[model samples]
Target: MTPTPHDLPADLDVFLAAAGWAGATVEPLQGDASFRRYFRVRKPGDKTAMLMDAPPPNEDPGPFLRAARWLDANGMRAPHILADDAARGLVLLEDFGTARMRDYLDQWPDDETAIYTAAVDALVRLHDLPPGPFLNYSMSEYQREARLFTDWYCTARDLYVDAGGFSAAWEAVLGDLLPRQRPGVTVLRDYHAENIMLLGALEKQGLLDFQDALVGHPAYDMVSLLQDARRDVPPELEARMIDHYVRAAGVDKDTFLADYARLGAQRNAKIVGIFVRLWRRDGKPRYLELIPRVWALLERDLAHPALAPVAAWFDANVPTALRESLGGRFEA
Candidate 1:
């Protein structure tokens, strides 16, 4: 199926018309496996607007909308929803330009500390969102997502771990995790270097990919930051950030460590699966290149007693040949 503009579902035009975001060149922005298409619409004498076209009946923008609102109210900066048509599954948002946080990190590596600290502060605000009927980021969801490593990544690469091996490891790790998730906190489920913006003190300080936000482990976002699949933050830098986040969040030392270990494992599991899915389903091989850094980070984090079971499992059963292949790809 060669996808084209006409294939952009019919409601997009109607949404552009209703929102007065016309005559702008709508070019697709790269995104994950969602019907979401971001168009950099540049019109004559008009402030740039990012037309978020997530076609309806397949995908819903409700969570994205609600999360954006929540972030805005909580003193974090996600793009303001300029216009919304839930039925049409389209949203027009204030464009913050293309300066993503990753771009800044690449350009000015020395500015990492300040940029990351600022992002973490904003994250603190986001996580401070008061409890509500918003769905819980329960262990079950994490387990389900964690399984993606095998189902997608391993499977896509013709790699496999026996059921006994997989189950034995996951069960032990999860048992440890159950106790650690005691004082739950909101999780941005997918907060990473890429999801953030580099526009410091500008209009949109951060761009939110908060559609997957959930109430879960507090350490989740921290894990996302340190164990980023796309880029490897040095271990020393990661430790500093860990301390910064824990202190800023006002959590106890032991409590933060336990949860951090658990969340780190959870984050690694999710990314392993996601990378595989991106490759197999979306044909995105770029993620494969990052696999080694991710695995190395996971290996380092899993050195904690909390993740010993999982660490050993990968050590024993996930296969050296497979690890060598994935690890080498990531290193390159």
Candidate 2:
């Protein structure tokens, strides 16, 4: 299902020609589990640009294009949209280069703290930005995303859906919990290691795959960064990072911890299901390898006792084999 560079539309030739360019070469860029495809472009005497080959009909570049403009105006760095055909679903972008935070972590282990700290700070700034129409991610939206866990993790895997109570309980919890969150700023839904690029000592951060941003809790992005499933951000370091945010935000510890735990648990549950869907639907089983770490994070945040019922439900009904496969017992 992955499309190659050769699959690009003939419009590419016209666009390149219109720009008065010569001797352009295209190289397939890194991919993610989405309808979009990217390629790096090489043009003489200029900085690099990216070619977006979004699949027709199924995916639209409207959201991304609008978001890019919104972010650019708001002191954020989203790729500028150069050209586009709404019907064809293609657009050119400012290339953010090929350095992923995951790869960056692979190269420099010692700089983990600094890099993650920078990302956290970036997240805080995004969250604190003035509100806009595009920023809205209301309760209905939260319910929809949270439902992914039940759909994929519970139903697709057929592992456990305890007592018919899980659904109602989760819904009830959201009904009560969601109102507590203060929302307004933009949330780059996937702010983890993969979407961010460490561009040369993090001076100019490279942001990609940010079309799904929503207006949600400020703590939500922080939870995504500190409790990333893809990479190992040490527990001690994560704690310190949270503390740093607390100091920066100038909020009370108890209030911040409660929101952090609630949203962290919420995000991780969604990710557990997301990885399941990635494996089952997208044929990307490698993501399944991180399920355990995400589950471990889920358990840690669930220990707050607010999630006691949800924790107990998982304990009684979820299969031991699945627990093992995902990454051992919660107690472990």
lDDT of each: 0.72, 0.74
Give the range where candidate 2 is weakest over 10 consecutive residues by summed lDDT: 323-332
Give the alpha carbon lDDT tens digit for every residue of 70-155 in model 1. Answer: 77776767888889987777788878777888887798899888877877776676667674236876656766877887787666
The C-alpha RMSD in Å for every predicted model, in order, reads: 3.3, 3.6
lDDT of 2 by residue, 204-300 (tens): 5667777887776677888878898888789899889989888877777777787777778778888888887887888888777788899888878
Q: So what's the TM-score on candidate 1?
A: 0.87
- Specify the highest-TM-score model's number: 2
Candidate 1 overall Cα lDDT vs. reference?
A: 0.72
RMSD of 1: 3.3
TM-score of the candidate numbered 2?
A: 0.88
Any runs in candidate 1 off by more than 4 Å, and if so which? Answer: 1-11, 157-160, 179-183, 202-204, 324-332
Question: In model 2, where do residues sit more than 4 Å from their true spots?
Answer: 1-6, 19-22, 160-164, 201-203, 324-332
Summed over model 1, clashes come to 4
